[model samples]
Target: MTLFAVDIGGTKIAAGRVTEQGDLDGPVLTTTTPATQGPEAVLDAVAALVRQLDDRGVTAAGVSSAGVIDSSTGTVLGSTTSISGWAGTPLSHHLSQAIGCPVFALGDGHAFALGEAVYGAARSATSLLVLAVGTGVGGSYVRDRKTLTGSHWAGGHFGHLAVPQAEGLLCDCGKVGHLEAIGSGPGMLRWYYRHGGDPRLLDARELFTTADADVTAAHAIDMGAAAVGTAAGGLVNAFDPDVVVIAGGLSQAGPRWEQPLRASFTRTLIPALSGTPLIISETDAWLVLRGAAFYAQTRKDIA
Candidate 1:
């Protein structure tokens, strides 16, 4: 059965079709998320996207969403402020009502790891982990092709880990010295500003432009990478997974960002786990959407 995969982030909504064999079909359809209009409008937006699909042979639909999701009931337990009024929304119920198909949902992190295992970088690996560092940090670990949602559905929140001991680094989750406070796009930007790296710098792009020569930009990037790498290292020690996938906006910033990440990740991993493949995801909008579809293919609750 073909699966309709929907990826709902704070800024965008993307949809794609996943064939039974796990290949993504056609270009992903895209639109801006109506996050500001409140949760109902966001649900309507997703339903509208599903309505445009060729549903004749579709058997199920899945969602990768930007929140802590209760996967069993397909409800969003909580979300970042980016998605206004999204908390406590029954996602699967609403989508099932709209599409008339088995609807499944999971936090975006798990979907990303599932996508990697089935259709992306980590294909052929029995166990893997994925970290998506973007506006904020999110990730999931998959073993035996099953994504772990955790008892509290907070399994993949690697960004909130206080692995790094940096001072004054506050995460959006209202914590101090979190991975997100240093590893995400905004985190790097916040670091740049806090370190007095020319207050006029607007964002991550501008900071990276001169990172080669600018001490502050270079320092911020390395610090962020170190936090991410350190956190990843800790996870590797804990899970002993075979592969790790790194995706998200900062990953696209090229080696200026990645060199440090790789270096720090290397520094953190133990000897036996050192060879675990570190993959840089081709994490475009399509792949992120495909992650959702990939998860639905195996999620027993929906099947």
Candidate 2:
């Protein structure tokens, strides 16, 4: 069941051979994505990585990419500008042709969700939501060891959900009041900046370090927590899932982040959904990378 798995991000392209026992088989190969260089260059980088394992006996490849992916067709329907010339690219076909194997492509959020379902926080839960709150917010739903990608391959993108209570924030998608606009890492940083916080504190690491002492910084974090809690409430009502795992960069805020998120989530939930499990997974992208490998090897179409 060893397969070549690649995680393609705006900044880096990571690839490795995945073992049958749910682990990477050897040292991971890493390189810059050359994202702005165009889709052709991105494909070139990936093809080069696949060629790195000539004798690995791998028969399949899986890609976890940052975008709204059409998994079945291996197409990038839409993507952040982080990777220029990426949208509409035939990612799956190009890789499959170059590597001489079936290639499965999945959104990074779904990859993370599936990976967590099989190996991390939601391993014991049949149906769970994996919510990642980072520079951007994305989500995925896993049920019975499979991910629901929806009709358009946009199933797990939950960041654009609107939060009626939140105000005066704009999402990159040009929507005001969306959860991403209010809850993502940059959103929180923006919150702090717009509220007259000291300009010296730039990222979450800095703001969180001064959380106890800086009123604005603390408020920004709490605001992000409240937004997630509110969005989770809506998500649960729609999906009716009992398990939700939160993972991403902001999850590293520790107790300061968890306590508020828990309180708000609890208060927002209806009586029937009380005490539903909300787990925080480790803040690591490797989990999603594993999921990509797992999917490439396990998907019936690919096999």
lDDT of each: 0.83, 0.84
Q: Please write out the lDDT profile of model 2 over residues 13-64, one tens digit for every residue.
A: 9888887666978878888999889999999998898688643578788899
* Candidate 1 error regions (>4 Å): 300-302
RMSD per model, one decimal: 1.8, 1.5
TM-score against truth, every candidate:
0.94, 0.95
Model 1: worst 10 consecutive residues (lDDT sum): 294-303
Highest TM-score scorer? 2
Please name the candidate that would achieve the greatest lDDT relative to the true structure: 2
